[model samples]
Every structure is written in structure tokens, then in C-alpha cells.
Target: MKNARYLPLLLCLCWGGQAFADTPLDLSHPAAPTVHVEINNVKGKVTIIAWDRNEVHVGGLLGDGAAPLSIEGSENNLSIKVQAQGHNGWFNWSGDKAMSDTELNINVPRAASLKVNVVSAPLSVDGIDGGDIAVNSVSGRVRIDARTPMLEAVTVSGNVAFSGHAKQAKLQTVSGDILAPSLGQNADLQTVSGHIQASGGPWAQLNLSTVSGDVQLTGELAPSGTMSIDSMSGDVQLQFPASLSSSVHASTFSGDLRSDFGTPKQPEHGPGSTLDTVAGNGNGKISVETFSGDLRIRKQD
Candidate 1:
């Protein structure tokens, strides 16, 4: 059995003439404090960290059969692109099959702006205090831990986890779960066929929507804040403190509606139910709607 495992390695070595090679990368460029950095990767992993220095440092490895990484633009604005040679068409490009992975570890100024784009490559960003940050990925897990002014992340078919403080945040995913345990002020979350779990926000405005995915929110609402959640065939649950002051309005068709604030009024002849009531002083506004899914509002323990 040990020889059987070596046989595959021997065949791989014979077929490719050698093992996969790694090309080291160590590059640095002088950059301004408010520089804008853009990265585009097609395969492998990308890790970005914020540093106090006013320069950009990139160190990583490029695997065999992968093209050389390219860095372009100037100090004020920089762009990095990882391209694979001779792979163009969509049907011909099997992600990381013919091309080797490209792993990058980059450090930039804390005050700089960042924009990243990836396809089938996991991305991670951490410890950044900066301007607008945006990441768009296709089928790659994205994890962001930053304190920025504005943040937007979107992915398809990969999970997203965010833990940071932002003035404004917008997160969206398709067929992938989202977990935001510590989100910031204004948040807008949306998903399709994926669940959402979030907490720890005194948001001024919060909106969550899903299609065929469950939604769970537990946090404190700001005074006079507005929260709205809509779902289609998915359950919704909201947990707030006992001292919450909010006007809750919930409606559902062919689904159960239960709340700890007040009793709901169900039509005696129809297939719909609604709850319109006020809790405490009614300083905040909460609205929830669902179709064929249960809605539960509970007080936090």
C-alpha cells in the first residue's frame, strides 16, 4: 500500500518530468499614505494586512505552470494582476487544473484604499483602518476584519464572514452562508439560498432579505432606528433586549407569526396573519414580512 502511493507519485513525476516548482516573490514599491490598491487574482489565496509604513510590500509564491504576476501603475494608484498564460475561454479554463495556484501576502498602508477581485480564490483582509474597501469574488470564501469608512463584499457560491466596524456596509451572497457577528452602523444584507446570522449592532438603519434561506438577527437597535426584513419561504427570528422600544409590524401568508411584544391578530376567514403593536415607548420601527415561513420575535436572555 505504501508502494502503491509512491506509484502515483512516480507516475506524476514521469508524466510532468518533475515536481511542481515554486517561484518566490519579494517586491516593494513606494506608495503614498492615501494610495489606492487594486488586486485581481484568478486562483489560490490572497491575504492582505494593513501596516503603518507608507509603502506596499508583496511576498508570496507562484506555482509551476502559472504566469508571472504583474504589478502596474504608480505610487498613488497601483494594480496587481495574476494571469495564466494561454488560458482564455471560459470552457477551456478549468480553475487551477492546468495552471498552478498563486498565493500572495501583501501589506499596505493603513490609510490606503483597497479593491480586490477574485475568481475561485479565497481572500482575507485584516486590520485595516482606511477608506472604501470593496471585494468581489466568484465561488471563493471571503473573510474581512477591518475598521473602515465603507465596505462592500459580494460572492457567489462561497461563504462570507465579516467582523469589523464600518460607517456603511453592504454584503451579498448567492448560495453561500453569511456570518456577521460584529457589524457596524448601517448594514444591508441580502442572500439567495443561503442563511444569514448576525449580531452586535446598534444600527441606524438595517435591512435584510433572503429567498429560501433562514435569517437570524440578535442585537440592539439604535434609538429611532429603522429595521426591515423580508423573506420568501424562509424562517425569520429576531432577538432583542427587554428594554427595546420599537413599533413592530409583521405579516405573513400561510406562516405562523409569534412575538413577545404583543398579541397578533389573525383573520378568521383568510390565510394570512399580521401583527401591529408597540413595545416600550415605540422609538424604533421594525417591520418583517415572510411567505410560508415562521417569524419569531424574542427577548434576549
Candidate 2:
């Protein structure tokens, strides 16, 4: 009879261990129309999708040794975080290794402002509109497809791809390529040793720079927009609309300059080259400079 009494307790203990080893998560919270959402994770994949409902839903499996998911705040703002034992945030994620990876799939309001930070994990966000968005990761690819007033994504040694529109956007990486097929109006992209490719913008203001990576830009410019591109030792290819209107200025230290708008002028006594000309009404400005990178500028057919 005494053994029977302990049987339920033993079963409960075993079930508890099982639950901790493989935690199934399904949580929901009421949110405002344009609620703010913040989430942090380490070494796991996070996927965030925008939904019409005025609620936030978090689902997926929590890896072992991770602290119970921490969710705080109210309908106006929300914060979600998953940490391993002794993990004090992004700076102190080296304490525990038991939590190999935690898969997180979160759903937020369509217009919710979002900020996500992760280390060694991939992040994906899509379908958000009219709210601010920011993502930071280390050694993991970050992809975003959203339309917002402000957007920023940064990573190290991982590719960053953005396919959406924003009033203002910034994407940066080190040793990783950047691809923006549908870039926004006012944007800046930078890289240390990674290539940059951008298109689909009649951008009002655009800036692109790289240390040792090639740059390719194909798109139109706004009526009075401005663009600046700089590179060191990497080639540059720029394609503009057939009805382009800009004051083009280009210079190279020891590289070549090729353009359809005008001929490159070589100094009579130096090894450098320069191109300065105007296209259309010259309402906009375009500048390209490189230390040792060749520049090619052409008008779309």
C-alpha cells in the first residue's frame, strides 16, 4: 500500500523531466493594433509573420535547459525572451550549451513595431506594414520583407536580404553579402568584404559603400534624388533608367571609368580618370568614387 502511494509521485516526476526536455509552447496575448514587440533568442531560428488579428501568438519547441519563456508587458507593448541558465542576454550567451536550438514561430499584428536580436540564429520576418522594424544577429542570416516607415537589419558574416519598401531603410553586414531587390526610398547599405546588389527603387536618397566588395545598382532615381556610391578595390556597375536626369560625377584612382552618358577624361599628366557630365534636366545628382575599382555606368535600353 505504501509503494502504491509513491507510484503517483514517481510518475509526476518522470513527466516533469520529459516536459523540460521537450517543451511544447503555444502562448497568446492580446495586443493593440500597432503594438510593439521585442524578442530575443540565442542559437535558434525565429520566424515572425504578420496577421490581421489583434493578438500575438508564440509557438514552437523550446530546447532543453532554456529558462521558461519570459513574456512581459500589456496590450500596448510586449517583450519575449528565451534564455539558457546563467545567460544574461546577448552579451552573456556563452554560459550554457544545453539549449542547442529553440525554434520560435511568432505571429504579431500587421502594423506592430518589432525589434529582434539574436546570436548564431537565423531570423525571418514578413508582411509587416507601417511600423518600425529592427533586427540584429551575429553569424546568422537575416531576411525581412516588410513595408514600414523605418527599417534596419544588421549581421556579421551572414547574408542579409531585404525585399520590401520602407520610407527609410538601412542594412549593414561584415564579410557577408547584401541583396536588396526591392529597396526603399531613402536607404544606406554598407559592407566590409561583401558584395552589395540593389534594385527596384526610384530612391530619393541612396548610399552604398564597401571596403573590398563589388557593388551593383540597377534602378531609377527620383526627379531630384541623390545617390552616392564608394568602393575600394571592388568593381561597380550602375544601370539607370532610359529617361535619367542627373549630374553624374565619377573618379577613379588607378581604375577605369566607362559610361554611356559621357566619355571618361584622362588627365594629361596623371594615372587617374574622371567623368563629369549631365543627363536630362540634371535635377538629381550621382557620384561614384573608387580607389582601385572600375566603374561602369549605362542607361537601360
Candidate 3:
């Protein structure tokens, strides 16, 4: 029994180390804030939590119903090799069976910068602390929770959700919704088929354009810069704090325009379909245009 137990333990250790022995990656980039990670998951959620270090931490879950894999990293950097035994391309190009052979789990520093590239999988990042982040996917939802913002999120077929505060922000999505909060001076939002919702701080200059969805702005839009909103079939909602003011140039082609903050007065040049109202003095420019929906402006308490 002693010999049997010894033989089994040695065999297991040898087999584990030899299973995928041909992998080629250094998997280490010591003490770097520029943390890089690549995940190859056929299916399964990839979750990352940030730490306070200046290094990158990585972990992943791969294959469908595959054996659990433990991913280990010190400061920053992680790699997961695809199991070659799951490939049967000559017979089937199916991931269904290949999905059950690999798995991973890891923890990373929150303030470290990240570059994540993935294929056909949803990537979720929560409690990630710092640095600018870029996430690209074939088709997946990118969820980010950061304390401060320098995040640039792009996706082809998945929605993006960013939660935190930012100084300068830019977001592009092909067909996904964007929810971001507390942006700083300037922001550029562009999308094809999804809705955009943004709010908070130092609203210096805002430019939003969409082809098939609506645009909604809430909270305090700084009274200093230019703001523009354009959409095709959806309406526009602008909610402003009491102190915010702008040079209003708002109109609708086939839809009614209504304002609760009152309107700016226009100098009479032979009145036709023109209207104006004023408070004391206007601050900046606010332009709203829509094809078929009403423009509603409200004042927040």
C-alpha cells in the first residue's frame, strides 16, 4: 500500500506538468503599470477585480464545462494555454466539446492599466481601481467599475457599462447601450443602434451623435462650453441644474419643442415660426435636433 500510494502521487505530479508542455510565453513583466492580459475562453464569464499595486493580475475560465483551472500571478501578467487535446478540426469545427477542458481564476491590481483582447465572450470587470483601460471583443458585454475615469471602451456587438468619475471620456459602440456617470470637461459619444445616458461634473464641451437611438442628459452640465445633441428617430431629454445656462438654439422639424427652463428671446426680424424667451443672460450654446421626436428640457432641483 505504501508503494502504491507513492507511485500514484508521483505519476499525478508528472502528468500535470507535462499535459500542455509546449506553451511559449514569458508570462511575466515585473513591476509594470502597463499590465497586459489575453483571455481565450470558448465560453464562460471572465471576471477581474483590481488591487492597489502597480502590477497587472490576471485569471480566466475557459472551455465549456471544463475542469477548473487555477491561475496564479504575482505582480502583473498571466497566460492560459488552450488544451490541444480538445481539438478535432478534421471531424468538427465545434467548440461544444472543446469547451470542457480548460478553466482559470485570478486577481489583479485595481490601478494598473489594462489591455484585454478576447473572442466571442462576455468580459466583466468590477472593483478595478485605476489607469486607462481598453477592451475589445468580437461580441461581448464590457462592464467596468472604476473609481476615477480614463477609460476608452469599444465593442462591435456588445453593450458597455462604465461606472465612475472621469475628466475626459470617449466611447463608441456598434449596437450596445452606454451608461456612464460623472464626466469632466469634454466627452464624445457615438453609437449606431443603442441609447446613451450621461451625467455629472465640469461639462465643458459635449458632442453626441447617433443614427437610430435617443440621447438623454441629466445633472449639471457646466455653464461654460458648447453642447450638441443629434438623433434620428428618438427624442432628446436634457435635465439641468438650476444654475446651468446656455445660448439656446433648439428646434424640431416635425415634433413640438417644449422647455420648462424658459427660452431665449430672439430679436424680431419679421416673425414666422420663430419664438424666444429669456431669464437674465445666457452663458453658452445648447443645440438639440431630432427627426421625429419632441425635445424636452427640464430643470433639476
Candidate 4:
């Protein structure tokens, strides 16, 4: 009787092992030069590559038990999403009984605008050079190498790394670090307890903020550019070329301040310090404030 009862268990184990079927994916559709594309996946890696062709091609494996990809719209705008079987809405599951991991490798026109959302799937995007690119995730690391017009990427507890050019970019995280090797004309980066590191040239506007994390910036400011930085208890470091022309004003409540431009002033009977100096002709503006974190300003060789 015990052996008979164990047969059911053995069958279940066999079924579980073969439950996830790797369904092949091959779909193509005509696309406009600047078509808007959106893709959503809950728990699998998504890779988007830019192609010279004027059509969007999707080829990958769809996990069994998952619904067919919901592809909608026309050549100008399109939406692609993966959902669970018999489920009509999106669900972010992260435990036993979660959906099988589906992989999506999509190729779109180089100039198509793109957007992707996922719960815990890492996203990689490359070569997009038109419109805007936006990505959102719950806990998935995002990396982009695109020369788009605008970029907006946000995640919760996932790191973000960008290495490309954009007219305007906004990157944020709630406990994840941000690395931008080449910032755009205007960039805004924020995090909570996550470090921020960026480098670029002649930024017209730059905004950085963090709580309990460090901020490191090495770039150039435009002649009329403006920068604002705020932190509760994080260190801030700014590195600029020797030929920088900016008016800097930085203050801290109970932290040390060091600068290569000018000396920091301390009140006679206060627990705060300030740095009010001008670099070169002071054509730009910079403002920094912190609660209890150190500040360092240096010249970049």
C-alpha cells in the first residue's frame, strides 16, 4: 500500500520536472521608423537589440504554462506582454508556484522608442537611437547602452548602469547604486542609501540626491548650467577640470568640508560650515547641502 501511495508522488515529481516547456518564439512585424514599443515581463530576462531592419523580430523561448504573448497595435505603436496562464492581469510573484522563467530576445529598429517593465528580470538594451527609452522594475538590474533622446530608468533595490548619450536622463533607485559613465545634457539621479557615480561633459543641468550614501561626480558644467545636490548623511565629491567656471556654495551641519578652490568658513559659535567660492569666471552655479556628511571638491587632471 505504501508503494502504491508513492506512485502518485513519483508521477508528480516526473510531471514537475517536465512542466516547463521551452516553446520557441519567432514573430515579426513591420515597424515604423520611430515606432513606440513597450514590453512587459514578470520574471525573465529581456534583451532588446537595435537592428537596421525596419521590422521588429522576436525570437526566444516562452516557458510552458505561460500565456501566449499579447502583441497588440500597429506599425506606429506596439505592445508586447507575457502573462501567466488563465491570468488576465500582471502579477509579481516571488515564491513557490511562480511562473517559469521566459527569455525574450527582441530586435527592433534602431530608431524605435522603447519601454520595458519587469518584476525581477534583468533588462539589457542596446543601440536605440531615437525617441525615448524608459525601463522600470521592482528588483531587476538594468543596463542600457543607447544614444536616445531621453532616458528614464527606475528600480527598487536594483542597480542601474548607463553608458551612452542622451539629451535628458533621469535615473533613480531606492537602495541600489547608479553608474553613469556618460551623462547627458540634463541628468537627475537619486537614491536612498545607494551610491551615485557619474561622469560626462558640459551638462546644462545636474541634480543628485541621496540618503546615507555617497555621491561622486566628475564632469563639466555648461557656462549657464545649474547643479543642486542634497543628502541627509552621505558624502559628496565633485571633480571638475582646471578650467571650470562655476560659482559653488556648499554647506554642512556637522561634517568636514574640503575644497581645492577656496577655504571653508566656520561660524564663531555654530556647528556648521560653508564654502562660498568662485571658480574661473563663475559663469555656472552649484549648490550643495548635507546634514552630516563630508564634502570634497577637487580638480580633475
Which 10-residue span in candidate 1 carries the lowest summed lDDT?
Answer: 87-96
**Candidate 2: tens digits of C-alpha lDDT, residues 1-301:** 7699999999999998876775788999999999999998887789999999999999998878787785689999999888877676644546446676888999999999999998888889999988899988889898889998998988899899888787788989999899888886888999999999889778899999998999989999998999999999999999998789999999999988899988999998977789999999999999999999999999887
148-249 per-residue lDDT for model 4 (tens digits): 889999999889999978789999999989999898789999999999999996889999999998999999999889999998999999999989899999
Error of 3 at 173 (Å): 2.1
Q: List the residue pairs that clash in candidate 1.
A: none
TM-score, every prediction: 0.88, 0.91, 0.71, 0.92
Winning model by TM-score: 4
* Per-model RMSD to reference: 4.5, 4.3, 8.1, 2.5
Report lDDT (CA) for all predictions: 0.87, 0.89, 0.62, 0.89
Lowest summed lDDT over 10 consecutive residues: which window, candidate 2?
88-97
TM-score of 1: 0.88
lDDT by residue (175-280, candidate 3, tens digit) is: 8888877666778888888888888665788888887767788865565677888777677788886676666666666555677767623335531112244323
lDDT (Cα) of model 2: 0.89
lDDT (Cα) of model 3: 0.62
Off by over 4 Å in 4: 1-19, 92-97
In every candidate, how many clashes are there? 0, 0, 14, 0
